[model samples]
Target: MSMNGREKITNKKRLKPAKIVWQVIVYLLLITGAIVMLIPFFWMLSTSLKESFQVFSFPPKWIPDPIKWDNYVLTFNSLPFGKWLVNTVIITASTIVGTLLSCTIVAYGFARFRARGRNVLFLVMLATMMLPSAVTMIPVFYLFKSLGWINTFYPLIVPAFFGNAFFIFLLRQFYMSIPTELEDAAKIDGLGTVGILWRIIVPLTMPALTTVAIFQFNGAWNDFMGPLLYLSKPDLYTLALGINFFKSQNDVQWNYLMAASLVTMLPSLILFFVGQKYFIEGISLSGGIKG
Candidate 1:
């Protein structure tokens, strides 16, 4: 073999170890971070299964020797966890449906229609996202109060039908990313605008739509302030607020609280795992061609 060939082989051999070392370091870092992130969750799980006394035991036990699985059962019995779960599910599902339908329709209009001051309107809509919910809290509360929606699911579920700015932006970005050729072809085949949207755009943007659903579902599931503001009745409380049943002026049931928290967290965790693939894909394609 030529000397140049020998030199190239030697350089390749030297570079391979450096690449492997770099990968190993990266993996180690990722693993360390993952462990760190998981520690609090592990602690929560541990505490949930421990007796009240065991929870603050000196030299804290990572593994509850006498696992109190009864804490979960006790949580349900002690609080109306089942009712809270049902209420939360109802609110979340309604909000998801409302958000998806409202945002997508509005987004489609914004993306497909060529109306006057379209850009200005779009900018104005996007600008709403900059305003904090706290800014309009009082006015919205009075509006709902006037409508007698306070202490009812209407305050929680109805406003989602109006289309959220962030959701509209997300859907609009994804809708714009779709190729106009597809719509044009559908039109040539005697499809109407709504037909094109329903058949062509909807299927193509499932990932983005799934992302929106996941986000809205998560937000609704975890919304504490909204339910707290509108739902004064214990029976109407969502799980986020219902979990506070474990707290009182004198005592807090830490174990039951943790157990209930784990239960409340499960749906969101499951949904994220199920939709993560689509969620990632949608976000990646959402900005395909920034308009």
Candidate 2:
């Protein structure tokens, strides 16, 4: 072999071990992170299956010896879990529908339409996201109270119809990423602006819409403060609020609480897994797009 060939081979040999070592280190770090993330869930599951006494036992049992599966049954019987589930479903479904309808229109306009102050208006809208929720909470609550929306689902579901800044920004960026040629083609086919948006833009931006739906669903489902502030009647309580039934001044049902929490989290977990592909694609498109 030539001297140059011999030198290249030596360099490759030296680099191979270094690359392997880096790969091993990466894999080890990933595994460690996976374990750390999963430990709490595993503990929740273990506690849900164990007798109350086994939960705080020394050395911490990773598995239940007797496996008290009745914790779930008892939890349901002891609380209004079914009613809470229905209320949550209603709020989440309504919020997703409202968010999609309102955000899509607002984003489509921001993405496609031209006006003198459009850019200025868009900047103002984005600025609202920087304001803390706490800053607006009291005023918003007072406004809802003035409208007699307090102690009702209206306060929770109605605000969603107004659209959110983050979802609008996400959908707008993704919409901007779509080729303008598609809109021109639709227009040449005699489609109006709204028709073009529905037929061309919407179909092309399904991933972004799915991302919005998933986010709104997760938000409404996990919202404790909104439900607590707006909903006073027990019948109107969401699963997030209903979970507190396990708490009392005298005693807290740890096993039942864990079981209920796991059950409540299942829907969000399933939703993310089901829409994960579109969610990731939407995020990539939204981030990659520019004015």
Candidate 3:
């Protein structure tokens, strides 16, 4: 071997340590971030298991002695928690279905259909996202009241049947990534627009749909204001409203409230963990537009 080749090999060997150092730095940052995020959840769990007295103790107990299993029981027994859970499930399921159906069809049109004024309509829809809920809250409330929809689930579930701007945009970007040739070939085989969408486009975009479903599920499940405004009856109450009512009546019981919060949070946590693969893939694929 030449002298220059021997020196080049030595230089490559020296570069390996720099690469290792950067990798170690990245790993340390990730671990620090993970710990920081988990601290609040850990504290909540610990507080739930503790006695009321132990919650505010001087040193702050990280573990409870008896590990109050009864907090969960008391939380359920104090109110109609089971009924609240059922109501939340109904609202969440309806939103997921409505969002997926409406958003997918709208996005398909925006991605594929060529029509005049299409871009204007899309920009108008996107502009709506800038309008905060506070701006529309009073008019929306009055509209529902005029429809005699107060104290019913109609106000909560019905609006999702229309498309959401953000979900439509996400799905549209994902749909644009597919080659136009596939769509053209489908048409050549005598497939109608709806037929092609259902048979080919829908299957290809399941990841994006899963992302939409998870987002809707989280939004509906955690929604407190919508139910508080519309649902006055205890029987029709969702977990979010019910938990607030419990807090008000009980006069601030931390252990019980934490337990209830954890129960309310479980379904969302489970759904995200289960759908995370598709959820992440969908976000990445839909994050940009293609030429």
lDDT of the candidates, in the order given: 0.89, 0.89, 0.90
Q: Each model's TM-score?
A: 0.94, 0.93, 0.93
Query: How does model 3 fare in lDDT?
Result: 0.90
Model 1: lDDT of residue 144: 94
Report residue 64 deviation for candidate 3 (angstroms). Answer: 0.9
Candidate 1 off by > 4 Å: 1-6, 279-291
Which residue pairs in candidate 3 have backbone atoms (N, alpha carbon, C) closer than 3 angstroms, thus clashing? none
Model 2, poorest ten-residue lDDT window? 281-290
In candidate 3, stretches whose alpha carbon ends up further than 4 angstroms from where it belongs are: 282-291
Instruction: Please say which candidate is ahead in lDDT: 1 or 3.
Output: 3
Residue-wise C-alpha lDDT for candidate 1, range 1-291, written one tens digit per residue:
999999999999999999999999999999999999999999999999999999888889999989999999988998888998999999999999999889989999999999999999999998988889999999999999999888899989999999999989888987887889888988999999889888888877777888889889989999999998999889998999987645652577798889989888988889988988885554654533354
lDDT of 2: 0.89
**How well is each residue in 1-291 modelled by candidate 3, as lDDT tens digits?**
999999999999999999999999999999999999999899899999989988889888888887999999998898799999999999999988999999999999999999999999999999999999999999999999999999999999999999899999999998888878888999999999999999888887877888888889999999999999999999999999998988887468899899999989988889989998884554553533244
Highest TM-score scorer: 1
Report the Cα RMSD per candidate.
2.9, 2.8, 2.9
Which 10 consecutive positions of candidate 3 have the poorest summed lDDT?
Answer: 282-291
RMSD of 3: 2.9
